[model samples]
Target: MSDKGLFISFEGIDGSGKSTQARLLADHLRDAGRDVILTREPGGSPGAEEIRALVLQGDPDRWSAETEILLFTAARRDHLERTIRPALAAGKVVICDRFADSTRMYQGLSRGDLRGVVDRLHDLMIGVEPDLTILIDMDPTEGLSRALSRKGAEERFEDFGEDLQKAMRAGFLALADEFADRFRVVDGARAVDDVASDVRAVADGFLPKRRV
Candidate 1:
């Protein structure tokens, strides 16, 4: 692992398995003796988790796009203060399931064009992007099927349905060009282990040599 901290984030539309891959990468690096912190947003720290429920658990229309953007940024600020920055300061590899990219897509793509707001808020309050972002790309129809098969209170985002998901997937792909230096697009339609193997390979290339 790098002695200097590494920050990584996993991003994709719902059920693209980014979260699972984030967890697997965390575990894989830990097994090789790297210190890792695995977390997610719209929740990571305690205060952020509270905000997450407010933004993600209610009716799909509970919060307007503008209001939801504020909530997500608020949560991200708390997460950075209480969870991410501290871990990175301690030289831990911080792997987050979703970060500002979700905001860029969810609010900026599906609901409204809030990319400027998202970017400015991030620049103002949460001024750090992940060192690497793994975008798990897959067909939205398949993603929705997989997402709907699961049960969770966090289904508010999924309730937006397949059309939005497809649009969001395209939005994420487009980001590859915008953030080419930090973005890696991986096909997520494969088996879990296969995708994980690919993810591990990517992460290994990004980080320092294994120290175990």
Candidate 2:
């Protein structure tokens, strides 16, 4: 792949500060004069946004594991076709807040089948993988507490309870271990600025030489 552009993704449990760091990195890159596009999965494009509403705020009891996975992929397909691919083709650095990994974690928690879902999605859609994935690792209990304290509402899968979140965390960690080269697990317990700095360092490693 060319250094002209890069696709970097931030992944983590809710309240792990992935969005915060993603925005910070985008700002840093923009200040340094890099063309960057900061976006999120499940809602990047118009079609995806509608799907996101359904998936996130709609009736959870009406959703099955298979149906949920399909909805996610449908949104992802729209996002890629409408936003991600175009930005990358324009040679802009693309920073996605959440991507396929989130689906693997969430759906894996709901379904207990990680390998099949991830592999099938990779095969069917999601042609380009992130150049680097920053997995903001945090303890599920702490992360959940922070999330609930901050947001004050549990939507859809987040309402699945604490044990599910813990299992999802374990799934993410296991993926990090298996794909060491592609994954960077950052300790998310640090101060916000500290975590952002760590994320910036990881991003800079993939970026071309430039003073930030």
Compare the candidates by lDDT and give the number of the best one.
Answer: 1
lDDT of 1 by residue, 1-212 (tens): 32369999999999999989999999999998899999999899999999988988879899999888899999999999999988988989999999999999999778877889888888999889899999999899999989989988889989988989999999999998899999999999999999999999999999877555
- The residue-level lDDT of candidate 2 at 151 comes to 58
lDDT of each: 0.91, 0.83
TM-score of 2: 0.92
TM-score of each: 0.96, 0.92
Which residue ranges in model 2 land beyond 4 Å of their true spot?
2-4, 152-154, 210-212
Instruction: Please report the candidate that would top TM-score against the real structure.
Output: 1
Residue-level lDDT of model 2, residues 19-135, one tens digit each, is: 888999999999978999999977899999989888887455768777788898999999998998888888899999998888877885546675587668767786667888999
- TM-score of structure candidate 1: 0.96
Model 1 stretches astray by more than 4 angstroms:
1-3, 210-212
Q: What is the lDDT of residue 69 in candidate 2?
A: 83
